[model samples]
Target: MCALSSQVRPARSVPGARARPETAHATRALILATFAFTACFYAWSIIGPLSPTLQKHLQLSEFQTAAMVAVPVLLGSILRVPLGILADIYGGRRVFSALMAFSIVPVAALAVWHDALATVIALGLLLGVAGASFAVGVVFVNGWYPPERRGFALGVYGMGMGGTVLAALTAPRIAKPLGLQAPFIVAAGVLVVATVIFASMARDAAKPAPRTGRVSLVAPLAIFRTSARAWALTLFYFLSFGGFVAMFLYLPKLLVGVYGLSKIDAGSRAAGFALLAVLGRPVGGLLADRLDPKHVLRVSFIATGVLAVLLGFSYKHMVPLTAECLTLGVVLGLGTGAVFKLVAQWFPDQVGAVTGVVGAAGGLGGFFPPLVMAMVKSATGSYTIGFLLLAAVAAVALSVVSRVRGDAR
Candidate 1:
């Protein structure tokens, strides 16, 4: 009990209290953490890019193919909660190193033993461990920055989303020449190198965060159930980050259906869409530092709602559709950065637990919209209703932002 109790830190009665990071290591910490996160994210989402190849090799049914892609997303998304909790208690350095070390096993397994549907699905569940790195990296980066600057630092860290872009670009190109297992081989090598670099260099923020309240593994769940602020933030991220992820995964299919573009062209554009969001994070963080995060949230939600509405009407038009999609990408990235800015501002002392809950919300949030879009498209033969539903959700979240704090916007 004593050893177990030592690993899990208690909660703070006061939120947003922590010493400044050791400046000497701050730059080094940010760089190494982002690098490690990039490799982890590559492992997390690489299956999406490799799915078609896997489907051909395994002769998988459509349902089976979809399941293989989705299992990792589901497991990786839900795992953020406990992983974040672990990062806080055990420290990001140990937790991150361990997570990647374990991830290498599944990556290596999939490279060689991926013939049967059951075997692939089981290994994919293990690979989801890589996606949990976000919560860990956030807590890790949060430890290194003061409350005011976390918006920017974490935003820079969020650039790790480029891992998806990298996977999209690299998986097919490399697999065409080298065979199906080659991409997994390369990803495993990257993780191995990243694990070594991170374990050697990363440090948590200065120790012993003020702990006036007792906490446990389930503390985040309790707060998630009880706290309206956490819920509000969760909803906002659900819309913003969730929307970003949904679009990342679904845009190619959307383009092919609506514009009748070739698969290669649609995929290239989807990669570009992801790039826009990747670039937007740091900008969003900078805006959060300069302006109030509330302002950032308001602009992001309002703009996102408006753009989504525009997209619904213009889905068949190539130019306007592209413009709206591109703008939506940047706005969503800003909302993601601003949400964490609020976390640092309001719940700094509980960064990891709170982040776990919020990050899990973001992850789970991505699941519904693609489902909605597909269902609405199937039933009505138009995606307008699905998008309008998304806009309605955004407006509701904007209202939550108005009431979440003391002021109305």
Candidate 2:
């Protein structure tokens, strides 16, 4: 196994040393990438909050609604592999611009054809590309920060995840005034502006682009097959980021069904959940940088497992349910930050390729739980089974983490 021990950072440049220009450039890239990521994610997030309204309008069954909501997540997630590789090869500025430009098509289609489920499903597939922007940002940001500061830098870049908070908070309210089309129109506009600004301003870090004479997409995927560390990170992200996405996307539906909250109320509450996670991500990164990330993982997984079981039982009471959900958000957010820190540490040379594999798993992590929840609901008349299943998975992850060696306690 690759050493999990923390290595010392390279010595800081002397005050008289010429690092200012380089630092400025890295900051510029980091800022722009974070903004563009937030915008792209807003488009990715639109469907989840709106799925209930669409369900009511179309008279669809619960399972169908869940599937509809998950389809974009599934596609967005699966595409991260290639997108990350593309960012690594062609540069993040170019790949991110193209991604945002393409996403506008689907967002605009949703605006014009808001009432048609077929149109939404078809266009939704295209819009999912926006979700792949996470990979692009990870590869881009990793290029800028040195290993010593990368954990915190990535956690800051990760603040872009708050885009889901923006969606959960706003999509429902926007739909209230201007109809279902309004939110999509707004998202399209956001993508347009982000694309223009990022294209004009963004630059890849000074790292040399990987010069594969002929890029074979399949070849990059070999990381997952060959690297034990990559698989471990992939599994952790599947739970951490996956759990976060699943809750952000599905909490509105859950609250509405179990507690009888209005769509707007549930949406606002879910926004709170996402917001806490957003805030916690950086904290996790900071902690990981200070302590061994393996220990951070251990604490996050243990706490997350406990919280998941609590959420399963607490649904009947809003106080405990909301508390558990919110706490779970912070824990999962930390897990996410710490996992990527380990990725950056472990695969310094191949962050993009490794991230593609890990990110796809994270996306799939978000995708499956909704389906599982839907199935559980269909058969058992409650979502408890899904939460308990998550707890069990958390336990499994903890066991994997416990074996991590070389890192000092």
Candidate 3:
């Protein structure tokens, strides 16, 4: 583990002195990777806000509409592990560019094809690669920083998750004006640009020491078994990242359904929630560095449970409810950054693989909230049950953290 950890850590020149030129180079890499990865992730999540418009245009039922939007995320969850393996073997620079280029085809196809279900499912599969970009960015950025400084650098990269903020904000407005296909066309063009930039400028560590042989498929499973810390972090990440993605994809629908807001209005409010949460992400990481990560996480989950319950019950009072949701978003966002910092600390060697395993679980974690919402609404004709469940889950996560050792983070 120590040997593998060194391979991912950047080579340092001065023991105690700062070098300006090297700093500039690393800063530039960080900025570019953040933007590129952000655009890719943003494109991955564009379907949620646009679903209602597409449904209305095609005269589709609610169930059909939900499938179109949710299936891509489900696919994305499954793809992260293999994508992480690819990054481990080939390096992020090559794999990220190739995947982005490959994504262009399906995105373009969505632009040209008018068939609703077929287009959505096909494009959704293609876009799963974008979620894989998380592994790409992590491996890329981790190569630029030492283990001690890695949390902040990766925290900033994680902040690129703000891309979902951009998507939540703009997808509906853009789709409304230029029609459904325009967003895909623009997303594809942006991807092409990102691929070109990454190909030309991105750097990797000198070729990794030759592996003994291909690692077994059971490697990640074995790591999971040996490290109780990994499981705890996984649960925490499930609560934080899971809540973030779920809200990103479904908040617009929640707003429209419960609050009786128009699609445009609901989208804007959802965007506001995402934007606030994005700002909170880096703050969370920064806090982890100052306070104990376990403590930071404890507070985050507790606040999340409280806010989630408040928002869940707030449907009766729309004005105050919006404020409550914004608060929940911030708490969940901060929790996400802190949780990743914990991962970096515990599984330093398997950052990419661990990130993939934890991330895939997080994605699966994301899948449930929407389904729960649907089921509860279907059963009780209200979202109250779903929000209560979210609160309970968060509370359990908080309790679990209290039992975990403080040094793990």
Candidate 4:
């Protein structure tokens, strides 16, 4: 069990306090937290865009490169469980700033010692700290918004994932002028600036209940055991958010290898995918808010499955491939938003711990696909099998969604 501080603040129900002022405070907190998340995601995913360059320089096999790109994601996924709990106990502002500050060291180290494989891998694991920021930010942002507005607010925060797009578009170009190490150096600087701004500007929401005793470490597990819906959400996110992560990290490699495109062009296309997905997230949230989340999810999963099948056929024409990729981006992005809306709806009281567990599942979802893609590509000498697998998973998720009974609202 994790012991919480005995000190508890009163809820904002004072006679003179008004809703307008509280709304303003919540908006400010959301903005700062979203920007902070952007910085963290940029640092967390920096390695993906650099993987092709690193592979060429180090003569790494496909499996080795996939492993290198995946290390941080694995840590990021597992650490979210604890970090989310800490945010729930200590408050998001403090925990989030501390995480950003801690990440600077490893981001800087990766810049200085990127040539050594072992050192790069070690630093990448430490870089996973930045990835854990998502759980913290989710908990933080969820606390500030009312139930009706949470979906949209969380969707906006999810846009910070555009940081991955930023990395994809900029890292290679930055590496060209300043060298391969420059990207990490710049990412560390961004974190430093974000940490200062967030700590200074962000405020935690008032707690609804006073802390009377220690929070059990096993509480999250207990919640998972009791709530079949939580498990369903976990599986759904594993496909949606996980697929998004896998695509972001693996797309550059795929583009470069399959299309014979230059690294710069590949990165640009990958950035497009990231951008479309990032933009689609908020739309998903808005739809979930207005419609049944299950309906939104059904549309998204079906679209994703259909698109994955079309992509599996391996269209060689640039126009068709680009169209398919962009369409998938929209579906996956919407699915990501819809899944979290469900989380916020179903587990409002345990947002922090629930976010941690579900987010971890999403991260783990992202982790395995690259290895599978790499292995399948290695064995079959094509990415067709990988696309087929994505379609299969989407179908399975759709089936699960159909079985679950609940009011989306």
Candidate 5:
């Protein structure tokens, strides 16, 4: 068994040396990277909050609506590996800027052609480029910070996921007056501005070892083969981050369909869930720095599983249902932060490659739950089955955590 006792040691400063420029660079990188990530995420998830509008306009069934919302997640999940490799080679500035630029085309295309269902789906696939930004930002931010501080730094960067909340809250409001297409235009505009700022300001930290040979395409797969810990972390993240993504995307739909909430009200509540998760991430990272990550994860999974069961009861009372959803947000957020802390702890050298594979798993984790929820609703005429499935998955993850040893910090 691989020991998980390895902890990142603090960097020692040279005697009487003040590296003010380096410190400044690290701060600037973290901020810019976070901004870029937020913009990309906003673009990637823009379609989700607008799903009901599209469903009504296109007269789509539940399954078709779910598929439409999920298309960007599919490409986003698969492309992280290559994008991470590219960030490793060309640096995040070029790769992230190019991704933002490319994403603009689809966002614009969707704005103009959304009347056609086929066009909307096709454009959504292209928008997956925006979702792949997570991997690029992960490698970029990880490279900038020291191991001792990486968990917190990455967690702060992860807050960019609040872009989903931003989309959920704002897109519908924007669509109300400007038309359904206006939200895409707004997202594209944000990307344009972020792309410019990122390209102009971002810089890669000096590599510890300079690259000499070409980067192998198969490097991520090779790393995956060698690291049992990577697989473990991947599974944990698949549950943690995946569950968060799935819920973030699906909450608006759930509120609208089950409780008959207005779009604005549902978006506001969903945004609250996302906001708590976003805030919890940095706290989870901070806790991992002080305690065993396994313990943190144990608490997280247990809480998540229990809450999911409560949600499965499908309370008609808005107060109980909303409370359950928000609590899961906190557990999931912390779980996500702890998982990445482990990534940086266990695989510092292969952060880029491992992050790519693991991030892909996280994205894939978000991709399927909406479809499952739709199918469950179609077959059983209720969402109770979907919530039960989430509880079951969380229980299984909790069991896996207990069996895995050597997770001390």
Candidate 6:
């Protein structure tokens, strides 16, 4: 139901009209939008790398820390759909800049108010602004590329998701040396700079040739209602992107508690897991472009399921576990890229809304696994049960994927 001014204007009959500005403007917008997303997401995920330090300093339990980590993700997931809608109705340039600017306040507060639990929770929820940034990027980026080339363009822009790796690799070590609050101040600074750059430089392509038929508020609902394949894609994303986010959030804990790694070592390991995905993401998109997105989804789900199960068994053996985590990271990253490629191809005209729906599904998928691990660990003091459950979710996703038939869309 949301709408934006058209990006591509109809050609005028008048001779020598300037048309080149549109192309140059759109390219700059894409770069700025990408930068904004990377910074916001980097800040959003810093909690993962800093969890152990936070726990030790604040004297918090595992459940409390897990809840702290999940809060922004949950809020962000819930808000993405609406934000996407808002982007479409208003415009991505304004929405994204404002959100990024607003994120700085809470991150700055966290820098100064480090010891208060209520302060942390409140700040975490506000950081969901980072999560909301994804929708804006999707709408913003999708406007720039033509339909046939969109997969690669979005996939390239999708590299911004790996901002989590920034947190994973640096937060623990940086916070350790400078004190825990320092990273937040750094994150806040980055957000403010990113916001200014995005607002000043980013521009939207003319909105897609507007659909002639009325776009209902229920337009996206029609996707779920009419396309069985939509749900399959949702499940596929749940397994792929969901697992990606969950692992990113929880990998520090897994490293420290399950493997007896030091906090710094755990952050590096978690960084390895997240950093590897950046390459896998674009590769997945390339594969989807060359082959069938559905087939890619099926194989990814099955392979990721097997690897996750193997990882559970490998947990006790360090060498095997490391190999399993690496494999899991690559497969999930490939799948994530493939799923978004399918979305762009499948609903070319409705990329904004479709991206919103799929993006939300991916976020929701990311939300549950950490909570599952938290509950499982709280009850049994082990992650095995949780890993097995993820394996089961993957199996279900793969099974469901088989029933849906379609081309990329």
Best by TM-score: 4
On a 0 to 1 TM-score scale, where does candidate 6 land against the true structure? Answer: 0.90
Better of 4 and 5 by lDDT: 4
Q: Give, for candidate 4, the lowest lDDT window spanning 10 residues.
A: 1-10
Count of clashing pairs, candidate 1 = 0
Q: For candidate 2, lDDT tens digit of each residue in 278-353?
A: 9888889999999999898899999989998888887779999988999999999899889889988877666777
How many clashing residue pairs appear in each of the predictions shown?
Answer: 0, 0, 0, 0, 0, 11
Q: What is the C-alpha lDDT of each candidate?
A: 0.79, 0.84, 0.75, 0.86, 0.84, 0.77
Poorest lDDT segment (10 consecutive residues) of candidate 2: 1-10
Using lDDT as the measure, the top candidate is 4
**What TM-score fits each model?**
0.88, 0.93, 0.91, 0.93, 0.92, 0.90
lDDT of model 1 at position 25: 62
Lowest lDDT block of 10, candidate 5: 1-10
Residue-level lDDT of model 1, residues 37-74, one tens digit each, is 99998888777666666767889754465567767767
User: What is the overall TM-score of model 4 with all chains considered together?
Assistant: 0.93
Which residue runs of candidate 6 sit more than 4 Å off their true CA positions? 1-27, 207-220, 407-409
Clashes of 5: 0
Report the poorest 10 consecutive residues by lDDT, candidate 6.
10-19
TM-score of 5: 0.92
Q: Could you give candidate 3's per-residue lDDT for residues 230-338 as a string of tens digits? A: 7887788888888888877777877776667888888788888888778888788888867777888888899989887887777668787778888888888788878
- Cα miss at 341, model 1 (Å)? 0.6
Candidate 6, residues 1-409, lDDT tens digits: the string is: 0222344442211221222233654566667777888898998887778888888888888888888888888778767776776676556877888889888988888888879677788888888778878877887776666555555666667778878988888788788789988999899889988988878766655432344656454555566677776667777877888899998889888878877899989888877888777768878877887887778778788888898888776787888888888788888988888887777666654555666777778888877788889899899877888899989998898888777677533
Q: Where does model 1 exceed 4 Å of error?
A: 1-17, 52-67, 115-117, 207-215, 256-264, 406-409
Ranking of all predicted structures according to TM-score, beginning with the best and ending with the worst: 4, 2, 5, 3, 6, 1
Native-to-model Cα distance after best TM-score fit, residue 156 in candidate 2, in Å: 0.7
Backbone clashes in model 2, listed as residue pairs: none
